[model samples]
Target: MAFFGFKDFDRLSEVDLNIYRFFTANVDKVPYLRVRDIAREAHVSNSSVMRFIHKLGYDSFPEFKVSFRAEQQQAHPTNHQINFVTDQNFPTDIYEKIELVADRMQQADQVIFCAMGSSGALAEYAARQAAAVGFNAICVKDPFYPLVNQLKNTSDNLLIALSVSGKTIELLELLNNFINNEDVTLVAITAEPSSQVALMSRYVLGYSVPQQRIAKYYDLTTQVPALYLTEQLISTARRLAVQAGDHLI
Candidate 1:
């Protein structure tokens, strides 16, 4: 069995704790960040930051970052949860769900997939699927700005958002801006059934997962299950389009 102890982290001083928090929060934004950046952000000297990393069991700053990312990846493996699909299941429900996703695709002339952090990968995957079917599909990295621009003069378009918590500030802000816009359709896929995203979207698809018991742990169950659902939706859309003699590129 493998385990990690937080006693060392708990022993850190206030300044070190602040530095660690900064590193964790900005790691995704600055994956290859420099030690000087961390020191500057933490208001500490480079030497002190190096000492801190060493005390945290890292040989160097880069080594510390690598270990930190590895720890995160291990904590949230790509396939963290299992999805069961039995042959005995009814095809009508599956077909209905597929038709719902397919109908959304057929109605939209353009599509934008938006998400951040780990969920961004799912958004990108959805975008690619739509593009393959000859839809004007684009993946917007900066959610707020792109969404605001698109909503101003909305087309036959749809915004598909993938968010695990559904409370991300950027996404929430975008959703709030579009709440009164009837020209655009908003679809949200989230793990939280009662999340603000679920409540605000015109169409909400929930991905249920068992809650984690541990604190401060990355739970792939929160976001990864959506991958399966997204894939199913995309496949169904494509197959339906092909059946209708609508040659998608």
Candidate 2:
């Protein structure tokens, strides 16, 4: 939701003000910071840090961090966004998972992307990316009902559902209805591994990152990870296709 940005800044005490200033100046370091770390950096006690977060109207440290990160995302979105691709465990964890799905992708007759909102836009872009690599891929943006109907009769198709939260009701509803089909494979690309869309899908490619809605308007995550996965999948699938003696295009 929307919070009064600078208006709330004036309500803090001197100690809290110092901590706030440290946080603002070092906003880039906020993601890796702990409560004790903040206290140490601001030269304040742990209790003071806790109180500062409370003064900001947050109930917990993690909640405050989420909002703070979202704010930073909105303000400094250019080259400062978290790099999910080069992260330590990302290559090890995510690449292995991508390999598991690459074969299915190569074998699939059609690729269908389903999503709404910003995710829908990503799905369209992903479809074009796949098509550029010589795969038959399509995206369904809205009026998802027609897509749902079409999915019922489709077989040997890969459905990639793109949603950061994986909690979109329409997307979940579609998954619930289509999960029983053996010939139609379901894949969920989401940030939350435990989300409904992940559980319902046959396979999941999860991006574990801090996803938040900034000021109730900006979605501060999803696109980067989704695009990363799309590029990797297309590359891997292309490689595998060449290995199998099948020329794409």
For each candidate, what is the lDDT?
Answer: 0.70, 0.81
Q: State every prediction's TM-score relative to the real structure.
A: 0.58, 0.64
- The Cα RMSD in angstroms, rounded to one decimal, for candidate 1 relative to the true structure is 12.6
lDDT string, candidate 1, 60-151, tens digits: 67777667777667766676444453322223354565567668876677788888767887788889887876878888657646567655
Per-residue error (Å), model 1, residue 223: 3.6
Flag regions of model 2 displaced more than 4 Å: 1-84, 88-91, 215-218
lDDT of 2 by residue, 1-249 (tens): 222276666677999889878977887897689999989988999999998788777898888878888887787677665555655424357878888788889999889888877898889998998898888899887735576567667679898899889888878877676788787899998888789999988888887666779897677774777788878887898788888888785
Best-performing candidate as measured by TM-score: 2
lDDT of 2: 0.81
Please list all clashing residue pairs in model 2, or write none if there are none: none
